[model samples]
Target: MLKNYVAYVRVSTTKQFIHGVSIAEQRRAITQYATLQQLNIIDWYEEIQSAARGRRPVFREMLKALKRHHYGLIMHKIDRGARNLRDWADIGDLIDEGIDVRFTFYFFGGVVWRGTDKKIERVFLWIGGSPP
Candidate 1:
């Protein structure tokens, strides 16, 4: 089981950055999920860069940091995550390396995927309550 987490939170607009509602919501959800799963959040990377730009220095730095550590990556959702195919491919590579990629929105006790040649490919279940 993965015990550590590094969070990546992003906002596309300056307005959202000023208001901070989206970022705060994501952080709250991530914190709740971590608490329920008994996981430690070791680091956080926040950026105000737009996804359309497709060049987030902080996000790239976060990926590099992941390589030197043994922790899962957590984001608010896939949409808040990789905004392009290249970024998605990077996430896939991390999964292939047996790292967990968790989304706060889909935190149904966490989604588990097999990284090896196993018949049981995936499993999903609720932790605190019924599916929302």
Candidate 2:
């Protein structure tokens, strides 16, 4: 059986709509990744607010939904998933509860698994380059 997954796409600001990777681009990449991984995306949560901000209603909604359904989360990148330590910690908590969190981008030349020392090690080594 295919694992049910939820896709999250975010852009920090309205300005990003013009300059940075648009929501469409993130969604496209996530969709392709989901297809390659054979993940069944049962829902999608898109947000336009910065992850660094104190409040992200859509993100909270996604978290609530995940808690209820136990679906995996697939994000375009770590930045898209979380830019603040608090939010990152929330993701970690979900992982501790057996929720799978996946990033489509590779960091430090390798796959980054949630709740692993390797993920911590590679994130610090990340030099902000284009995804491979």
CA RMSD, predictions in order: 8.0, 5.9
Overall lDDT per candidate, in order of appearance: 0.73, 0.79
lDDT of 2 by residue, 1-132 (tens): 999999999898998866778888888878888887899999999888877774889999999999999999988788887777778777877787788888877522266544345654355335354432
- Model 1, position 68, has a per-residue lDDT of 75
Q: In model 1, which regions exceed 4 Å deviation?
A: 18-21, 108-132
Clashing pairs in 1: none
Which candidate number maximizes lDDT?
2
TM-score of each model, paired residue for residue: 0.76, 0.81
The window of 10 residues in a row where model 1 has the poorest summed lDDT is 119-128
How does residue 33 of candidate 1 score in lDDT? 80
TM-score, candidate 2, is 0.81
Best prediction by TM-score = 2
Residue 124, model 1, lDDT:
18
Colliding residue pairs in candidate 2 = none
Q: Give candidate 2 misplaced runs (Cα > 4 Å).
A: 107-132
RMSD of 2: 5.9
